[model samples]
Target: MLITISSLLNQTELAETRDALETVEWSDGAKTAGRTARNVKQNRQADLSGSRGQALHELLLRKISGHPVLQAAARPAKFSRLLISETADHGGYGDHTDNALMGRGAARIRTDLSFTLFLSEPARYEGGELVIDMPGYTQAVKPDAGDLVLYPSGTIHQVAPVTKGTRIACVGWLQSLIRDAACREILFDMENLRASLRASLPQGSRELLTLDKSIANLVRLWAET
Candidate 1:
């Protein structure tokens, strides 16, 4: 399942992030990519080891974790360090899947889902679309600044070449409590239904209670941790 969350960051937060990004130094993104991916990954990445990078990472993490829709869709158990990447002058990544596991030793996490939070407006760049090979058809994504797109990490995907200007985004992966994507989709639908029902139904209504029970039981049956 692919999910898009519009305006994940507000205008003020977006401005703060963009301003901070301007001051950070960038390096070849291939240095962090897997061996095979390194061959096709052509972009610049902000040095996450610096103070500014760490602060930006923390700020985005807080925003993502606090979002209700993301929580319902991902059910994230653990997260990888956010990558602030910039692509310009035809730089792009070829089709490749993310590493199944990320980090080392105690911090390692299985990448069940991947996400990209666009930091630059679409109008500022040209031809930098996130192309994903879906089950039957391929999808090209280009969302507004501050929007986020979430998809399964195992899918073959690529960043289309940026012919003009620049494309900057914060990319990351997460290990979800529910490993199965279909299960997560079902639960997400149920959660939305529950939210809608809550607005119209009386408190402690039997229908609401039954739905709550069903969702909880499914989580018990499917959750990895």
Candidate 2:
């Protein structure tokens, strides 16, 4: 499921972080890329172990991970550091999938979901669409600033080149509590229903109660921990 959630960061957060992102020093993106993936990787990423990079990681996790829509869709167990990537003239990431695992020992995480949070406005860049390859068609997404696109970790995807202006985004990987993609989709749908019904239906209404019960049961059955 390819899901795009808007306003993952509010204006205040975007305003603050955009400046931070602009000032941070970056490293070659190939530093984290695998052998095969490095061949096609041509962008740059923030050195996330630094002070400002750490701040961006914490900020994104607090805002995006806590979002209601993202929580419903991802059911995340752990999040990697928010990786800030930029593409300048003739720069872009070629088709590749994220790593199956990240971190070591106690912090090891299985990547079930991958996400890209746009930090720059679309108008600022020329051709930096997030091109995701689906079964029969390719989906190109160039969302507004503060919007995030989430997809399965194993999907074949690429970032198109930025010809005119630089393109910057915060990307991350997550481990979902529910590992099965189909089960996660069902839970996501049910969770959305639960949220909507809570507002429209009366408190403790039979309809609301029933839906809540279903959601709880599904989560209990599917959740990893």
Best by lDDT: 1
Task: Tell me the TM-score of each prediction against the true structure.
Answer: 0.98, 0.96
Off by over 4 Å in 1: none
Off by over 4 Å in 2: none
The residue pairs that clash in candidate 1, if any, are none
Question: Candidate 2, residues 1-225: lDDT per residue as tens digits?
Answer: 999998788888989987787777888998888888999999998876778878877888898889888899999999876788888888999999889999888788999999999988999989999999877888999999999999988889999988989898988899999999999999999888878888888999999888888888888999997
User: What lDDT tens digits, residue by residue, belong to model 1 across residues 1-225?
Assistant: 998999999899999999898888899999999999999999999986789878988999999877899999999999888999999999999989999999998789999999999999999999999999989999999999999999999999999999999999999999999998999999999999999999999989999999999999999999998
Model 2 TM-score is 0.96
Model 1 poorest ten-residue lDDT run: 47-56
In angstroms, the error of model 1 at 165 is 0.4
